[model samples]
Target chain A: MVLIYIDHSEKEIKKSSHEAISYGAAIAKQLGCSAEALLLGTVNDDLTTLGKLGASKVHQLNNESLNNFDAKVHASLIATTASNLNAEVIVFAHNINGKAIAPSVAVKLDAGIVTGACSLPSLQNGFEVTKTVFSGKAFASIKIETPKKVIAINQNSFGIQNYDSSATIEEMNLPIPTASVKVTNVNKIIGEIPLTEANLVVSGGRGLKGPENWGILLDLAKALGAATACSRPVSDSDWRPHHEHVGQTGIQIAPNLYIAIGISGAIQHLAGVNRSKTIVVINKDPEAPFFKAADYGVVGDAFEVVPAFTAAILKMKHNE
Target chain B: MNILVCISKTPDTTAKIAFTEGNTKFDENGVQWIINPYDEWYSLVRAIEIKEKDPTTNIHLITVGGPEAEPIIRKALALGGDEAIRVNSNSNDSYVIAQQIAAIAKQGAYDLIMTGKETIDYNSACIGSMLSAILDLPYVSLANHLEVNGNTATIQREIEGGEETNEVILPMIISCQKGMAEQRIPNMRGIMAARTKPLKVVDPVATNAHTSIKEFSLPPAKTGVKLIAPDQMEELVKLLKEEAKVI
Candidate 1:
């Protein structure tokens, strides 16, 4: 059987988890086996709905302590679960939590792992999987040769597929270890679409001049109902918060539409957003390298272009 | 307190990426190599800051790479580590690299182990958790802020849409990123002192790499951009809606 680890945030299932389930179900189908889900902690979403994304069974481990992420503890529990279920393959969404625990789980299970995997394994050639390497500058096909294999699917790489079925929920009973790490505080960004889960993102850069000029960008983002992000320099200079930064060293996002304004796309910057389905670059400089990578380009000052773009969007919405 | 800082050498961020050997190996010619930015800027600097507060703290550097990684290791030592260890291997396999670090870390009996959130090149972000698992230590990842008091360490890590503070006992592993510490340049005095720092080159223990690279390829190049006139805002909007269908 193939086991997929369901990741959730604040009692809500993450969008990336659906992609992972679909990918795992496809793999299970290829191997002529069943795909099951392992969800840790309590969530408000109906577990049966997971079957539409392709899991045949949803195993829920309900423990209050499990609500908080402890990589060491979670890894041990996952390893034990995989062993008890005779799972030949395990899958996870390669997000923050998955990246933290998948490797540890792989170590415990003595399984070969390929994180940030972009495609399903090619079983015809000894379980080979393709993944992005060198910060998305290139791709490397990795062959995982182990009895038990663990694969973490890259976010937004695999599209979710719906199956016409419902999964039966199974309450799992296991010895939960005491968490060695104690949670003290949580500061969440309220009332904003997270960059990771946002379908559209409007990002600014140093060319915007200063934090005082950010209202235009925010206005455009609001017009489109998109998330807002900044380049590394913008965040470093404190024009934007570090959490809003997206680049090689910061958060990586793969939104459906990514609009880059006043940003001369550096290779490091491109590395983070290159996975976006559609890229639009707006810069006053006609020779900006970002234009080469973008699907659409507009050479104009962001100060004028952004407001105009926002007005156009608002007008379109009003007409619709 | 003893702290082990893990670092790796990577091509300068601005270097053009190209593969040689039938697209199976990274081209090294004309490429400038430096300490990975995350490792040098965050992980090592934060350790140095901790040592500054407590002069009795010992910081050791470790890397699993070939002799070519020496210059980078020296740079890390110049930043603040007292000693260094290079496991004699150039394995790209995370499992093999983690195993080597685990071996050295066990013998050193360090109280805390630190690594960059992820190397800029591979961006696997797995070494810290893997090392902690092998050592049976609590693991905190993507920690942007860290404060230590006695045996307990308070760490702040970013989640999906929020940040969480966690308190963990000593003998734990952490992966650091931005907000952990500011970047520090090595002074001439530190550079001269780093030459004499003890750098022990140890042979790697026999460990099997479960994964091997099959091939390498670049992302598909984008088709030529459709440039829109600045004044034709409606045209651009129409293209986004009717052509690209994104809005």
Candidate 2:
């Protein structure tokens, strides 16, 4: 059986987990096996909804203590589950939590693992998986030689399908590892859209000049319901918070649509965001390197183009 | 208190990437090396903060690289680490590096272990998480901010579509990113003190490497920029309409 780790926050299921379940189900179909889901910790959301995404069964721990991620504890829990269910392949969404736990589980199971996987494994001759190498610069096809395999699918790499099927939600009773780590306090950064999960992202650079002008970038982001990002300079200058920085020196993100305004595409910055499905460059300078990487380019002042773009999107949404 | 920060010596951010000998190895003829920027921003800065909060606390910088990496190691020492360790190995495999680190971290009795979210060169981002499991410690990645009091650590992680605040106790592992703290340049006194700091050289312990890098190569360069006359805005629109089809 193919088992997927379903990650959740609060009671709402993460969107990327839906894609992971869909991808895992497809992989299971290709392997001539059934797809099941294993969710760790407590979930406030309805677990049964995962069935609509192709999971035949959902194995939920339903333990509140498991909600907070402790990698060793999770690795132990998942390793135990994999053994109990006789799972052949384990899958996770290559989000932050997945990144923390998957490789450790792979080591615990002695399974050959691949992270940042961008597609379904090519199962023609053997199980060959294609993953992004060199920080989204290249692709490599690797064949796992181990008996059990682990793969972490990059978010937005596979499309989520809402198939009309119901999955049986079963509570799995397993020994929960004692939490060695103590919970202190949860300091939440409440408002920003998670970049990895955002379908649309509007980012800026030094072209915005300073923090006061960040309102336009935020305006465009709000207009499209997109996450906000910046080049290293903007963050370095404190025009935007460092968490908003996306580049070789900052966060690496792969969204469906990335709109870069007034930013020159430095190779460092490109290394972090080149995986976006569509890139839109709005810069006044026609020669900015970002225009070369962009699918669409608007050679106009960002100060003018962004507000106009915001208006245009609002108008289009209103038309709907 | 003792803290261990694993740092990687990577190519300077702007160095042009090339390969040598049938693309099997990175061409090191002209590449400049530096303290991997993420490590500087996250590991070193946080280490300095911890040292400042307690003068008796000692921060140790560790890396698995050759003698050529000493300058960058010195740079890290100058960044406020109380001491340094250079493991005598150039193994690039994530598992091998993690094993080397886990060995030292186990013996050092470090109260905390920290690193950057990922190294720019390999971009594996796996060693710390993997090492956390090997050592049986709590691990947090992409920590934008971290606050430690006693044995507990509270961190805010930037997840895919949202932010998650987790509180894990130390002897934990943390991989930090931008929001952790600002990168600090070494002052003159710190630079002078780094020369007098103790740096120990140790041979690597046995390790099991599962993956081997067969070759290295740069990505193909993009075609030169395509330009349309400003008056030809409609032409640009036409290309987007028919060719790019991004509209």
Top lDDT model: 1
Prediction-by-prediction clash tally: 0, 3
TM-score of chain B taken alone, every candidate = 0.98, 0.94
Worst 10 residues of 1 chain B by lDDT: B117-126
* For every candidate, C-alpha RMSD to the true structure in Å: 1.0, 3.2
TM-score of each: 0.99, 0.89
lDDT (Cα, tens digit) per residue for candidate 1, span A163-188? 99999999999999878899899888
Summarize candidate 2's per-residue lDDT along B1-247 as a digit string, tens digits: 7899988998877776666688667667788898887789877798789789878787988999888888988999988888889999987666678888888898887878999988877676788888877888888888888877887777877655445677776788888887788878899998999899998899999876655454454445555445544344445545543565434
* lDDT of each residue in A131-169, candidate 2, tens digit only: 776677665556666678888998888989877988998
lDDT of 2 at A304: 74
| DockQ of prediction 2 | 0.36
Interface RMSD of 1: 1.1
lDDT accuracy of residue A58 in candidate 2? 94
Instruction: Name the lDDT value of residue B196 in candidate 2.
Output: 92
